[model samples]
Target: MTFFSCRPDTERRKVFHLLSFLFLAGFLLIQSFAAHAALVRIKDIADFEGVRTNQLIGYGLVVGLHGTGDKLTNVLFTRETLISMLNRLGVNIRDREIQLQTHDVAAVMVTADLPPFSHGGGRIDVTVSATGDATDLTGGTLLVTPLMAADGEIYAVAQGSLATNAFSARGAAASIVHNIPTNGHIANGAVVEREVPVDLANRKQMHLSLRNPDFTTAGRIAQAINGSLGSNIARVMDPRTIALDLTLRDSIPALSRIGDLMVEPDTLAKVIVDDASGTIVIGNDVRISTVAIAQGNLTIQVTETPMVSQPGPMSNGTTTVVPRTSINVNNGNNAKLGILRNGPALSDLVSGLNAMGVGPRDMISILQAIKADGALQADLEVR
Candidate 1:
């Protein structure tokens, strides 16, 4: 009778345990939704493979400089090019008779980008940089020059008035310069003479290249594409590329749809340091193992005091100059040991760093040391 009577209590305990599990699962699901990463468009992280910028280069000359042009004596090509240009304009000149000074002219290289879908007779901005010993490019105008592509085919003709962001002034022995005067940019400077041909509508497949390559990100991207459309539409070819098969779907419509889909990209945990600028960039997902960091600043100061030793009160002695210096060092007492626990979130990591009260440059060194000791769980890159 007792054994049969105990069945209700045992069943009640089992039912309570099941209820607890369900409640815990529900809480976890809610937390997962709350902690979701920010959504970004796939177009922001990747681009279509065939859609890219083309580089066009041209050998050109800049005229209308104020005697700051290339010296025609040593830069012989400048004179030769000038003679050829004059001959084209119906003016005859021999090599020996090429003595127009040409000090107001400079040989420069003109460069511009022919963006995808650029057509004939369209204008694009151009950058001109002096190739010779010319000092400044300000107040100069670029001459007509044929811009060529990698295939040695003429793509555009560039000619325009230069607008320089830098300037210079000289007064006999003193001169002040701001920015680089040898290089300048002219907006909408070149006219497109030809077209670079590529058929985008007839492609059976297209590839998406990530700006920042990561395997996890690539997989996530493919999954996002498939989840929005269907299975087998997007496939990962590698860590940096995702191939899209458009044979089954409508080409233009499908591409337009892909751009609208939001995908959460995975970024590698990294710390980038720019020593020249004293800048440090810490990734949001950066982590650290359990470690103790003790850092401090050491400053040394030196002062020079020159003294003159003269003969004192008619005592016969030669006057002399003596150099005196003082040196001092200060080791800051602000240095302290801080223990960091494993698997810190972004806030915790930032809190720990802020507690150290160090500058960006000092933080860069500390991060490098932590990475070397196998404590920092992120890629340390120095620029």
Candidate 2:
């Protein structure tokens, strides 16, 4: 009879636990909703495999300079190239003593990025760097030069007025240095001479790559995609990849229509710390699992005092010197470890640490130690 009478109490306890769990879950749901409201497009997460820029570089001459060119002795290529060009121009000067002051010129290397899907005749910007000992390339212009890619193929032609923000002036035993002319830029200076083939619509399916791969994030991405385009349109390939099945879609337009759909990504909690830069970055999702943190500074000081004696006021003894030393060590007694029980969120951790007057750098080290002690649940990455 007693066993049967205890049923009501057991039933009441079970109901109370269920209600408490539901209340906590509902609170967490609301917090998660408010946290990630800025939705990013799926296209921003992935890079198309072959769609990239090709670095093109070429050696060229920057002409029309004003008394700022290479020192003939250090740069042999400049003199040799000038002689060859002059010879090609039918100026026959023998003896290789071609020591003409090409001060109105500077040797430069031109560089440009050949963007993927670049077509012939497309214009691009180019960077020109002085390879010679030119003081400045300011107010100068670059001669027409062909830029070549790694394959030795001429990809673009660069020519424009050089704009250098630096200059230099020199005199005997003294020199006035200004902006760095060793590097300059030309806006819209090169015309693309080659095309890179990229076909986005040719394939029946596509893959979305994540910038930072996380399994939880990938699942969320898949859910977001399927929520917008309906189920079976997107599937998770891995933590870093998602396959989109465009074959079963209505048409190309339908697939393209979903590309603009925005979805909020779920990222893992992490705190990135750079010790060399004294920087600390905390993510909103980071949480602390109930830990105590204390901070203190230990300082050691050493001082030296030197005393010189002059033979007791000219008693004719060689001056003797004596040294006095003092050393002190201080261990601060101000900070004490404080207990933080059942720590739930990142702000609580930050507040607790900041309340102790811990700087960002010190906080990073303390957090790392807490992580090592198994008190911090989030990842602490030191870069």
Candidate 3:
């Protein structure tokens, strides 16, 4: 016990340092693995670039209305369209005759979305809305109209009975209406006439676009895909796109498998507020720092009463009016100070604030104050 060990102390300190370094490395490795545990399908996060929807538009006529169509005197296009339609039907009708009897038809614009790989003779729903000032389109049937793409190429033909959410009943003096009477929908009313060519099999690669862009999500998606396929098949090109090589005979099967694979995605904390409707939305990962806030209400009142003075039975004095007013102010003097000493999750923060009986609009103000003071750790958007 009388001797001091010199070399033992040095060696012991070195061993302790090595052990700490190993412990830190192990902890960080575990954390990295844990972050990737939550899995979401690739299909939910992105869409195939070439596999998308195309827009088609057409101008048509809705007929068979009970005198609720556009007036031919004001809407010249309706008269012109009616005459053209009649001429096509071999009736040889003139414009002057149409001007008097064309009140049963309305000019409408048809719109529809054509999905990818849509073949000829496929059926699609179409929306019909009056281009003229027509009162209603209920109980109307759309005429055969050619739908065209942006390139002036006809791709579909639409014709069917219209279904509308709106109804209007009018008498001589009063009328009641619901929903929109000028618009209607025709289910499976448009038949595809031409197909847009897409070669998914011959493509060298497949591109997926994210509905919501995030760098972390893109990386995680790539990692999960590469992990599932047992090769580096997928890679993140950017925050919003993921690319995969399709150089195999079974490209479709591979794509389906990739869609089935899942990966955890990272998200940013966000809070949204609508001042008009007093709506407040908070993300789950939202965190609040330590802070002190106080809230109270202030009230002010003002009332007025008029006093009348009548002339006496014999006196001829005119009646006089006097005004009496009262004013009061009350500011709540007992708002207790609220202390937030720690950052908490969104749920806990909401519960704590709700206990204080704070409303959504008031919460908006409080959040703004907290943000200005640098205690709120999320993006706040007011609409």
lDDT of each: 0.88, 0.79, 0.86
Candidate 3, superposed: residue stretches over 4 Å from native = 1-38, 93-98, 170-175, 301-328, 332-336
- Residue 9 alpha-carbon offset, candidate 1, angstroms: 45
Overall local distance difference test of candidate 3 = 0.86
The sequence of per-residue lDDT tens digits that candidate 3 reaches over residues 89-118 is 987868344336567789999999998999
TM-score of each model, in listed order: 0.84, 0.74, 0.81
RMSD of 2: 10.7
lDDT by residue for model 1 (1-383), tens: 99999999999999999999999999999888766657788888899888888999999889999999999897988878878888889887964554767689999999999998999999999999999899999999999989999999999999988988999999999999999999999899999999987786788699989999988888988998899888998999888999999888777788878877877888889989999999888898999998888888789999999999998887888999999999998897777897767756878887877776877888888889889999998999999
Clashing pairs in 1: none
List CA RMSD, all candidates: 9.2, 10.7, 10.9
Pick the winner on TM-score between candidates 1 and 2.
1
Which model is ahead, 1 or 3, in terms of TM-score?
1
Screening candidate 3 with a backbone cut-off below 3 angstroms (N, C-alpha, C), the clashing residue pairs are none
Best by TM-score: 1
Sum up the clashes in candidate 3.
0
| Candidate 2 segments whose C-alpha is farther than 4 A from its true place | 1-36, 64-68, 87-95, 100-105, 132-135, 165-181, 248-255, 301-329, 339-343
Tell me which of candidates 1 and 3 scores higher on lDDT.
1
